[model samples]
Target chain A: MSEKTLTYEQINDELLGMLERPHPSYFLLLLGFLLALGLFVLSLAIQIDVGIGYSGISHPIGWGVYITNFVFWIGIGHAGTLISAVFYLTRAPWRTAIYRGAEAMTVFAVMTAGLFPLLHTGRPWLAYWLIPYPNQRMLWVNFKSPLVWDVFAVSTYLTVSVLFFMIGLIPDIAIMRDDAILKGKKLKALIFTPLSFFWRGTNHQWLHYMRAYLIYAAIATPLVFSVHSIVSWDFAMATLPGWHTTIFAPYFVAGAIFSGLAMVMTVLIPMRVVFGLEKYITDHVVQSVCRVILFTSIIVGYAYFSEFFIGWYSGDVFERSIFYFRPFGAMKEWTLLGDQSIGFPQVAFFLMVFCNVIAPIPLWRWKIRNNIMAVWIICGLINVGMWFERFNIVGSSLQRDFLPSAWGSYWPTIIEFGITVGSFGFFFTLFTLFSKSLPAMAIMEMKESAHPPMRKETHG
Target chain B: MGKFSGVWASFEYLDETTEAIEKIRKQGKQPQVLSPCPRHEIDHALGEPQTRLPFISLIFGGLGCLTGYSFPAWTASDWVLPVSGKPIVAIPPFTIIGFELTILFTAIFTLAGMIGLIVIDTFRNPLPKGAKKYPRFQRDRFGVVVSCEPSQTKEFEELLKAHGAEEVHVENS
Candidate 1:
């Protein structure tokens, strides 16, 4: 429907209708994720039983796929906040339709990211020790550790993102509740009534709600930058060659937004199709998101070059060695299949470059960016590339440290692979269920943007 | 059922709604406007000051920052563990903790204040009986609810209809 022809009631019905009956494909998708989750659980069970050593992490390369997945998932959450909080503050109109889905993505992605640390610790039950509580021993978590900083940052990000999301959803949920009452869907009404907090859209509620929402947007904007910066500190504070650098903060933030926007597209393109939100999620919005992806891709590409340039320029032998060994195999001498010689580190490096830098270059052209299929495929590549990017940083740096004698290769076992897949399953499963249950688009905001019904022309 | 009652009028258009609110205020009575979404025009017509929730957020945010910094500083001083010859209480790292908590507390308290104010307003100026029965006010319509006596119900309804109200109801309980 054209913007002019769209009425408030139509906007309400179209957006809220998504929460009604689901298509079989949604259940199929949910079921597929559940199976992956089951695999994740089984893998966790096996790892806990057999110990964390069952995974590919060994001497010299302690932080492996789990840390990479942790960073990757955390990075995936940034685009949602960027869209919801940052874009909202800037009064970006296109964000109105996409922000809700992106905010939901942020909440779910953070929840998924929160699990990896627990999984990595191997003793999930004792994870509470990370909290700075006064225990029987009078011991507190070290305030100086970046890991502790990460705990504060990620948990805070999760809480703030959830509040921002729910604050945005309140008016829409109230609409759903009213609709449920109108339709006599008592179960849905029963569920949404409390969620709506007895919202009646009185001027009293909207006055405070609008002010509070703006404050949320303001606070959440800095939070989006801080959470990932703190996550970067997890690496930058380390003494490792490739991992320790001043640029990691901005570089990781850029990469996080890049991967996050890709994941948003990865989720939203399919969602717009499934929910018939093509009108709201128009080509303009898709192209706008692509432009951002392209811009962030350039920053990531620059960061990569800058890392190498700084490595060679700094004349730090260890840094130069790690940088050199990243692209060229540290174990190039090992031959396989009668003359074929390839190292996993080299392969990961090349894959990361190809996915992160080269894949998104086509988005500069309007035609290519406009092609939904092409954009979707590139987004998928960006996702893979981002994971490999984290892998290259986490794995390649550790595989060859300062002491050559300490150098060792890391390969993920089946259990690690299962857990990684399970993480995706966990993220998508919650996302799919969320899309079905909540207003996928900000309905009230859309109406607020559109021309309200007016009969008399009062310019004043 | 009480000495005071309410007259609820629903307008199909924003112009008429705001005009009615302006007229009601001119008549020396406070009018509550209900809208599907907030409008600057309605705010202008009602002339209520901006919500003070931001002050609440700022106060809580300051407290959070103090707590975040002090908790870590006090703990480090008490424990007195020396690592890498760094300061007993590192300011740079603790700033990260402080910053995060500032935002966290600001957000939590902003929401709390908004909810608290909404609850207080709901009790103080409760909606008329079956006010929500006109659900259009939650979707398309704008509603102007004014306090009036049972004797003034007809006069208020006539005033609302004159201002192009599509529907008007009076509750004398």
Candidate 2:
């Protein structure tokens, strides 16, 4: 028997039905959020009143969990604009399904990323001092700082992405405008109205939309690539032995996309259930993204080896010593100081190989890719592995730099861990609200996806 | 006075342009067939009429390319100093930057051209304050708008009737 199609009323009734008691998982998710939020607040407040000086942030490991989280979050944000604009322009059809959610996630994630650096600052209020405000202080912003470049790059990338996302929404707003189902409802239309930009979806309007989408995609592609590479430049620009390398740009960018894709899969799991949109975003589409994961995994693998090979080939002792010390440093001191790592680099290499390289090999097979449960499980492991990979690169490297005296091991303090979880809470809260409210997928894009303009049949 | 007028239908999902051409040939009517999607097939169906769109795209794409590269370069180079030890003006990096700008300009220009040519952006639903013969068009609906000379309205209406039009109406515009 055919299941009766649920009308807008039924869907709404079901949705509204849940609001009375909140979600079954809502209490748990909320409790986690509160605990995390409280811890983050306490951490920052203590630090601000006292200082990041109070934490384990010492000389050699200048950047601790704060900066690491910042980089990781920003990297995760990369895949969204990359999918929306870059993939769209290239005519990757699967993009229409997953791109919207990821794009929204991108905006929120960037916002989350922007928070950490500020929190980690010596004076949070004076953070604006970093920007060159034309106040009478006669103070000039440092033009030669990678941090300065980051402010501009990340902000510009965010602005352009928001513009692009809003531009795409204009036609849909018109549809919603005429839709009787949406009569007398106002859903923060203030944000949406500017986006609509008075779009009417007429032939002329469509023409404009098509042109805008293509051009924006084109502009955004490089911006997306540049943002993460620039983020890596923050590390590469530093004079640290392992961090300062030409290979850092490509290496960081590849790792970014690798982790970013894993995130996309993780987000997709919850989104599929809540939106009742399994059909719109299918297992086949989910599996197709694994190919991206596989490809990026290999590239990151090459970059990892490439960095080590280059270090050996160039015969740079400082670089070699730092690399060696990361994992198998002569820890005759028997302390887990920066000096006492038991093969951190080797461990990093194998762990990355396992998580990013080997673990994904099962996905190459058709069965595993198609298995929704297995896909979700793999995507979860992939995310955990990605976090570890970042730890190995940033954390371990910080603990074991060229100067052993300055080097020290750093772990995320209670507050540090809390803030990280808080960021996740913020991301999820925004995403959950977005999914529940907005059309989970782009209806217009999906409509067009199944029936694109056909190529003319050729005759010899 | 302009001569031919009639209605036509085509399988938009499957052989769209040919079906349109065959229908037009049978009636021998010089009617217009505006499709939801712009395709080369439609151009063939309409005898591949010359349009200034491609030229517009080229000109605009060029303009976009120029601006995308130059604007950022100028801002980062002449207007601003180098953020890192990197030079005041970075050219190699412009490959992605330049490419993106060109696409941006082309899109904007194309939009302007579309509004200027198709005249849809100006359409505040000017036909009537609340006229909706086909609300479905707001969603997934597509069609060929078969417009002919006003004198041939009767035959055109009949032709539209014969081709199994779900609905038909006269346009005030």
Number of the top candidate by TM-score? 1
Please give the distance, in angstroms, between residue A347's alpha carbon in candidate 1 and its true position after superposition. 1.5
Candidate 2 regions exceeding 4 Å error are A1-51, A130-140, A181-198, A273-276, A329-353, A451-460, B1-120, B123-134, B143-159, B171-173
Q: Model 1, range A270-298, lDDT digits (tens) per residue?
A: 98887778889888899999999999999
Model 2: docking quality category: incorrect
What is the per-residue lDDT of model 2 for residues B35-143, given as tens digits with 9 covering 90 to 100?
Answer: 3334444455556444355567789878877865675565565456545577765666554455555655555565566546555324422332112333334443334
Error of 1 at B157 (Å): 1.2
Instruction: Give the candidate number with the greatest lDDT.
Output: 1
lDDT at position A451, candidate 2: 39
Score chain A of model 1 by TM-score against the reference chain A.
Answer: 0.96
TM-score for chain B of all predictions: 0.94, 0.51
Each model's RMSD to truth, in Å?
A: 2.3, 6.5
